[model samples]
Target: MSPTIFYGQTGKFTFRMLATVLGGQSICILLGALVARAIAATDQGSGSSTAYLVVGVGLGALCIVAAGLMRRPWGVTLGWVVQALTLLSALVVPMMFVVGLFFLALWVTCLVKGAKVDAEMARREAAAGGSEAGADDDGTADRVDG
Candidate 1:
């Protein structure tokens, strides 16, 4: 796939990576809720199960929208909102705090590293383009016998 469409502008690699991560988080949350319902300790009732399902589905939807929006400037802000919601989920499942924190760290790292990679790629592309332009301007192209 074209990098511009899949990953957004040259300097926004972090946004693309963040979108993928959010999608993953959505699936995990849905699966975890179902698993928790299966476990005896957490088998509350149909009412609780429904609640879990609703939250999971809502989160999944949000992740999908956020992923698609990553190309926009507001995408990062939406990502932060998703992160906060994930952290807030700990109120329902205490263990989620740990999981949420881990993902939070991963999110931060992806943003930092992805931004650096984007910058490096942009720099290389600019250098290459400049060199090609100079060669054409200097009559290097015409000098080639072929």
Candidate 2:
């Protein structure tokens, strides 16, 4: 099995890792908005305040949507867009520069490491004589003959 083929399998580690990052980011965006409001940068009852909240909500929603889409190939592309938006949020909230960097690092790490692991899994599966089962973490392959 190729890495791409293996990655498409349900309940893979890469999917879990990337999904976690995006899910966590949704919460962070909301908190960041609250922080901006608390700092008085978003004037009370003003359009800027509402806009900030709206943007936060939108980004949070987008994160969830992206997470759901991760089973598809383009889902990863959507995640990249999320990262870009998070970094751009620094324009409104300076703290986002730090938050964005943290998440971005996680995203990249997960992609790189997860791909390697998946490719390893694919290699192992191939070596397992075309067994229906994938390799386990303990360097063993489960036999699942139909």
Q: Which pairs clash inside model 1?
A: none
How many clashes (backbone N, Cα, C below 3 Å) per candidate?
0, 0
Off by over 4 Å in 2: 1-11, 40-46, 130-146
Q: lDDT of all the models against the reference?
A: 0.71, 0.80
Off by over 4 Å in 1: 1-10, 36-46, 134-143
lDDT of 1 by residue, 36-71 (tens): 445534555444666676776787688788878878
lDDT of 2 by residue, 9-71 (tens): 333778778889999999998898777656555465555766677787888899999988888
Candidate 2 C-alpha error for residue 88, in Å: 0.5
Instruction: Quickly count the clashes in candidate 2.
Output: 0
